[model samples]
Target: MTALFDVILPVFLVVGFGYLVCWRRWLTEVAVDGVMRFAQNFALPVLLFGAIARLDLGANYNPLLLLAFYSGALLSFALGTGLSFYWLRRPIEDAIAIGFVCLFSNSLLLGVPITERAYGPEAMLGNFTIISVHSPLLYTFGITAMEFARARGQNLSVGGVALRALSGVLHTPLVIGILGGFAMNLLTQAGLVMPEGFWAAVRMMSSAALPAALFGLGGVLYRYRPEGEARAIAMCCCISLLLHPAVTFGLGRIFALNLAEMRSAVVTAAMPPGVNAYLFAALYGVAKRVSASAVLVATGLSMLTVWFWLAALP
Candidate 1:
């Protein structure tokens, strides 16, 4: 309980401060957009690079741990997707949006900073690994799901879709950053010398990423007004905050994860609905209302859910 309070409460306090500022119109929408653009294009990439560059991905890196986390995430996403389609009887696009809402998480925005505070810098590695492994899944299968729903009657070719998907992954700053950093690490492991100046610059830039990302998230939430899509959003928030984490906790224990790793897995699983849901919705012309609503509700509720998880963690 003490651990939870100590670890999670402060994060909520900071996020709450941002929300208050935006709610009061102290931070204008223009300001938020600029901030998000900068964070997404620059700050996040630098952070990913720096974190991955420093990773000692040698024999000690646990493939099983990565597999466990991936399996849990995949199962949760599948269950959510199936439920949204069958139980809710939503249109394909809306179902895809709900599926992503349940699956993808704001691990970068919320996970890294909070984990660093709670468990230290080393814990960030777990998040880095998870993101790296899941990036391909998100870019390919996730986006395809959205496209399939949106282009229900369109004659979209498989080859064209594959090419576009590959291009999207190649163009994404986050993906590039992860790959770049991993490549750098590999080269360094093979006895290449990274310039001190480059490392120092990346380190400094990366330090700014987390706070900026959080503030940007707050700004996005401010722009999102939960007027109509309340029911769908609420359902997604329940699944994300409750069902996902519960499953992760059970499976993590079954995988025999240590306390630190289990905590990391649980917290990651409990992360807010991803910003990507909104992005993908716009791209695929899905249930934009529901996607936006999910973002707002999940982010708002994450404060409470995170607190609960922290409190529950041993």
Candidate 2:
């Protein structure tokens, strides 16, 4: 317990401090936005780029890890939807919303900072592997699910949905980081390395990512405090905080992922539902209240679960 505290406490301290600052109005919303954007858009990308660039890409990359991680997510989604319809006596639309919340995680904003803090910079490569594809895949699943949940007989244009998903993939910072780092690593493998001076500046930006990100997480929690249906909220908590990570750990073991890879898969799976889960629900015009309630529930529960996963990591 002492050892675990030594590892995970400082990160939460930064998070709590950020929460306090925001609660006290020590920083304006605009200033908070600036700090979050700096960390999210710039610092995170740079850190991911550097970390990925230095990796032995061929050996380090593992597609099966993604499979294992998503398998758990899909299971959790199914469980949430099942619980909604059968037990909660909710509509199918509400079930869809519950499923969506259980599936997506706040990997970038919360997961990255927490994983980096607990496991150090190297574990970020594993975290990056998940973050890179997180949005694009979830976006596709989210859109399709929402479409089905609402009305159930509408036809979405395949080409249009594909285009939108592709566009999102192209614009995400995680994708950019992975691609850029892979390019750099490719060049290094061919005997050309990045200039030391250039890398030092990248490292400087990278250094700000964890602290700024933790602070930004606090700000985000303040920004989105969703409220509605306690039963739906409790369902989200069970799926996200308990079932998701448990299943992820099982899958990781079955896939024979290394310790670092296992830790990455389980830790990320344990994070709270993405804030966009609420946005996705809002956009689809289905289960908005259920989704909002789930977000708040998952966020509150994750403060403790995050520590459990970090400490339990192999």
Candidate 3:
């Protein structure tokens, strides 16, 4: 219990601080945007590269664990989308957005830091590996989900869709950083060595990534207020916090993951919805309300859900 409190309180404190700053108008949307841009484009990439460069990828690679995690995510995505479509009676696009909110989590922002704090820095390698496997699916299938929402009755363009899909991969700093790190790791394995100063610089830059990300998330929460969309947002949060994690936990057990790994997987599964869903919805101008509501709802409720899972775990 003490460990759990130690882990959870800092998160809420940061979030609360963000909420207060926003409420006081001390952190404007413009400031939030600038912070997000820096975190996404610069700091996060350095963090990713540094993480991957230092990983002992050859020995630690667990194909079965990766398969189980990805499979669980895919199943969760399908189940979330199908159930939302059936229950909500909404358009495919809106359903897709809600479903996405149910499955895709703020793994990079919240998952990394929390897991690192709970399990230590070594856990980050497993976390990043899971993220790398999910990134392609997120880029391809995730964009398709949004496009489905936005296209409505219009005829789909294969060429345009392909270009857009590829663009998603090329534009993501996370993906770029992962690839760059993998390349460097390969070179290092073959006997390449960097000067001490260069390594120190990379370490310095990487250290800033987590705090910046958490603060950016807080700033975003300040800007996001559910307002009139409370009911819909609540529904989305219920699915994201309760149903999604429950299903993932069951799957993890069925796959016979060890207790520690199972707990980690559950925490990862219970993460709040990704903010990228809102960004994509805004970019495509489709189901923006649902996307925004999901972000607000999932983030607001995740504190409780995370605590519950942590307590429930051994």
Candidate 4:
């Protein structure tokens, strides 16, 4: 009860406030777009850069931890894709888009803040470890899959498709931030020290990342109402909120992860699909409605599901 009130509700309250303001027409779409642009393109990338630049890669990058969390993610993707195609009769393209909803978790906005509130700042090393590669790995995989799905009967070369996927992943702002951080870390390790003002500016921007992102995310969710595709939405919510974390938890135990690692892996796996799910679907013009609705519905469902996972985690 205490954790539910103290740790979880505050985060959702911010999100809810965003939704409320947008629903009431107090905040216009243009304003929301600007806010999201600033958060995603600037603040959040700065946050990732600072965190990764400071991280001790050797100590924090645990293979078992990565395996446990990502194994669950891949399993959910495969299961979601297979079920959507075989049972739901969705097109191959739509099925891959839906599978992406299952694959990509909101590790940065929701996962980081909630984990920080529930545990502490230090416990976030594992969370950062997962996030550093989250976008690159999943986006590459999702884009490649979608490209292949679209390329069938279109005379597209496999090599060309692969290159396009790689190019898209490389150009993402988040991935750019991560690669920059790695470069900085390597430079600092070699005795190159940056000025204090640079770090001060990084801190300033980093502080605004989550609050702005969450509020922007709320307004974005408001735009994606649950109109139709009830069954597909339900399946996505189940896979994202329940199955992903369940697999991570089981694998965490199997891998004998420590308490912090267990919490990070399970909680991150439990996050709803990020807005990128919608963006991916929109990019390819497939399953746009289902992807958008799944993000909104699964986000609402995650409040209760995350509380349960928190209680269940040791």
Clashing pairs in 1: 4-310, 4-311
Please state the error at residue 225 of candidate 4 in Å: 0.5
Tens digit of per-residue lDDT, candidate 4, span 1-314: 98889998999999998899899999999999999999999999999999999999999899999999999999999999999999999999999999999999999999999999999999899999999999999999999998898788898888999899999999989999999999999999999999999999999999999999999999999999987998999999999999999999999999999999999999999999999999999999999999999999999989999999999998
lDDT of 3: 0.73
**Residue-level lDDT for 35 in candidate 3:** 80
Q: State, as a TM-score between 0 and 1, how close model 1 is to the true structure.
A: 0.91
Model 2, position 1: C-alpha lDDT score:
61
Model 3: which residue pairs collide? Answer: 93-149
lDDT of each: 0.76, 0.78, 0.73, 0.95
Candidate No. with top lDDT:
4
Better of 2 and 4 by TM-score: 4
TM-score: the better of candidates 1 and 3: 1
Candidate 1 Cα deviation (angstroms), residue 256: 1.6
Collision count for each candidate, in order: 2, 0, 1, 0
Against the true structure, candidate 1 has what lDDT?
0.76
* Model 3 RMSD in angstroms: 2.5
